[model samples]
Target: MLRFLNCRCLLLAGLLLLAPTVQAARTILIFGDSLSAGYGIRQDAAWPALLAKRLHEKSLDYNVVNASISGETTSGGRARIDAALSRYSPQVVVLALGANDGLRGLPLAQLRDNLTAIVASAQSRKARVLLVGQRVPPNYGAYAIGFHDVFGAVARARKAALVDFLLDGVATQPKLFQADNLHPTAEAQPLLLDNVWRGLAPLLE
Candidate 1:
């Protein structure tokens, strides 16, 4: 009888230990730019928020933290990453940066290095990374192509999933962009979430 009681107690303790692991929410950190920050729109209308809503709609156990700042560059992201990582303790980090750097015609090598370091830093914390690429405006000329390639190259090197062109469906589409032609309009938020979700959902499972 004592042996039976001991076995039941051990089984209960094992189930208790597994309960928290099964119910814990997965955390995703969106470390991005003005686009993700909802530059001119309300914060709740941003892509990150929309993504969170979508996750809820699907009944997924997850939470999203938006760490986007308008006009953020790779350098700026790298500088602030430690704090962001520390605060969020994310299981996954969505790295969407370098658009401002490309706009400023920053060197591609510098962008590559910054991005590589950022990915490595996140990996060191055992967090999975998803890199979101951005294309520079055509006015930047040949340098723009090179700048854009930095994202794919870094992602390939780091073995991180890449979301080619975060603004794929909205960029250069006047109807989807704000008056300045730099930010996505609220109407475009859903598509942006779709773009991110395509790359993010697979890794989540």
Candidate 2:
């Protein structure tokens, strides 16, 4: 009986020591569209998955929750933002929507408003936001330029950090992209992770 009690005491002590480390792990919410959803490749090859791996390798206390979906637009993200916040209760939110919005030539005003609302909602929940920007083809003309600029504008106005482009290094490399030329191949995932890391690192601190 005495030996049993002593074993129980040691187990309790070990659990007490581990309490803080367990509580230290927080959520990082990845909110985006197909670009982030690993559209043409394996899910594990996605940037968000790479982010989780990076966090683990660095021994950071964050877990990544990718709530991204294929064909998701800013309007869709806006409608679901609150639910995502409630579900993840994240410490940091990586906002990467608007690509589909640009592709569809959605009104910039609506895009701006939706993004603003999403950022505001996350901030209100005390989550730091890293807004990831997108760029469309030059063929889209002035609308493409406007779409690209809106992300930076929102980040500035909302006081959020910005990743100027998710495909910064990969975009210009056609061979790095999948056959569709819109999505990056698995090989390009790391570059995407690197792009997001620049803005996301400071928030982790």
Candidate 1, residue 194: CA error in Å? 0.8
lDDT of 2 by residue, 1-205 (tens): 0000000111110000111234446888888877777776777787888887788778888877788777777898899999989977989999998877877788999999999999999999999999999887778889989998999999999999999988887877877877765667899899989999999999996
TM-score of 1: 0.86
TM-score of each: 0.86, 0.87
How close to the true structure is residue 41 of candidate 2, measured as C-alpha lDDT?
78
Local accuracy of candidate 1 as per-residue lDDT tens digits, 1-205: 0000000111110000111224447778888777777777777787888887777778777778787777677898899899888877878899988877876777899999999999999999999999999887666679978988889999999999999988887775778876665567889888888899888988785
lDDT computed for candidate 2: 0.80
Computed on alpha carbons, the lDDT of every model, listed in order, comes to 0.76, 0.80
Residue 34 of model 1 has an lDDT of: 76
Q: Lowest summed lDDT over 10 consecutive residues: which window, candidate 2?
A: 1-10
Q: Which residue pairs of candidate 1 clash?
A: none
